[model samples]
Target: MYLEKLAEGKTEIGESGLPPRPPENFDMTKFDRGRKFIQDHVICHVLAMFISLVCGMSVVNLLEPLIFTNNSDTPNKAYRRYISTFMHVTKWYYGNIWEENNKAQTSILTVRNMHNKVRKDMTAHEAKIKNSESVDIDSLNHERIASCPMAMKDVRLSQYDMSLVQTGFLGIVVMYPRFVGIDCTEAELDDFVYFWYGVGYMLGITDKNNICKEGFHITRDICKEIEQQILIPSLENPPSQFYPMAKAFIDGGNIAHKNKLNSVESVLAIGYHGMNVKLPKLSFMDYCRYLFLRGFVIVIYYCPPVKKLFNKIIRHFFWDSSVLEKKMN
Candidate 1:
């Protein structure tokens, strides 16, 4: 019955799915603590974002149109798409998120608009796939679509899908913070989860179906179930598109960093191997890069000066300082 309620979100399309307002009785203290959590551990949160993205490749087929079929045609465009994502996510963490017409609110609406466009495009594509003759189905296309657990079910992105995505962001950081070198208190974690609950509401996830709606412990348990049941399983049995899509996303990350050495694969490799997920053998050079990244993560996390310096570099490279100042003020 619980799963059924979440699955129902698949049908709650368009603006109708969004809550009329943000979550009520907003705990500003908790929200501020959550913002501090991210601010204090910026490098860890950034690392967690990469880890989440790689894990998200598990739903590549469900996300194909949003990814492959969108602004990812060229390396430069892919870079822009991811950088925009980083900025939006940062705004959610740092800005006057719940305030009307703020960066966070506007960013969530922009994302919804983008989702609507994809929903329209996928509707036509889904129909084409359903009506096409078997003889017209090529091996590559068949494999890609067949890999989707939600294939032929509904071309539109569902609330259930958004719930899973919400997990991608909140999961690793809350459940396995140490994976990204985070060492925080339980109360702080709760505050962080509380912040995202409000974010979930603004992102069209109904209170009943919001991944983070249940507060800290329940949300953690839910994220644990998703990691054990869906995310890990998907990683263990990914389709042909998984590697390509993951590589494309990492390539964009490299672009954002303006240095290929800062590959998101560093996080992916460590996280997957830690989880006992089987991966193809990598070249010797790839292994060397992973080693370098491991060392980099360690130095940045344990060394405060290095961590501060790294944070400044990231802000300088990807964000507008003025926007942060304005939102924060």
Candidate 2:
């Protein structure tokens, strides 16, 4: 049936399984460019730094399955998992982030399908372990240690937690527009949210979590509820097992500095929401350093001279940044 519909020239499929007509005069060519050469050039650093230092690291909190006792003391595993994820997402995201055309849309779908496969495999593994005729603790421990089993041991991520991740993306859509210089228009925001809403569905969330209808306000309310109800309680009394994973993220050689920045930012972000999480402690001076890096990143990304120079650099050795961006899509 799906293949047959494609034979009929249907390009748009909505959640309701109906095809929506394309908007009139929507220029497919310009959307394919992602950002003009200069725009993609300027925002690269902003997007990268945001993912590396803040949003990337905070995803650990969303790994609610780590709260389970059977999966204690596996920060090394979590570190391995999240760091790999960070690298994949950063490269994939910035590589194709600016395009509004269909060609690049499959990237998210591919990632989502990968996520679904992993979830199904893990859930099956957990079920096998639980229904086993006997237990093998040592063997299980070895596998868990070797493979980073914090979130995979005897359970899967809860449906509610998965739902919360949808809200998290919506939060980004809401807040990104408020960036001082970036003109994230309503149409842009809607595209961003719509993309993630598909992601949410693939991740096993329900329509109730799809607050794109209620606007950012209600979307944020769901985010707040996730924090107050699940996030805060888990963090304040965080499981001992998850700390090593957090440590690996914070101390991992490749991304330690960014991890430290993430840790501190997590503290501030949580507090800003009138909530608290007992994040890994850092000294006052450490706090200053991360804050400074965050601010400095924004400054450099917005500086036109820097952007122009970087654009030249990319065109010099690599392909044109704009060409690469579109090609990635």
Error of 1 at 215 (Å): 1.7
lDDT of each residue in 1-329, candidate 2, tens digit only: 22122212212121222122223454434433333422344344333333323332234424333333233234454454444443333333334433344323344445555545555555666666667766674455335533432444332443434454555534533453333224445655444445444344433444443444344455555555555655555555554444554554445533533444445344334333323334445577666754564464466446757656654564432333344344323
Q: Could you tell me the lDDT of residue 70 within candidate 1?
A: 48
Backbone clash tally (model 1): 0
Question: What lDDT is reached at residue 203 by model 2?
Answer: 38
**Candidate 2: RMSD over Cα atoms?**
9.5
TM-score of 2: 0.55
Q: How accurate is candidate 2 locally (lDDT)?
A: 0.42
Candidate 1 per-residue lDDT, tens place, 176-196, comes to 776577777888899889888
- Clashing pairs for model 1 are none
Off by over 4 Å in 2: 1-61, 64-106, 137-159, 170-191, 198-206, 211-213, 253-281, 297-329
Count of clashes, each model? 0, 4
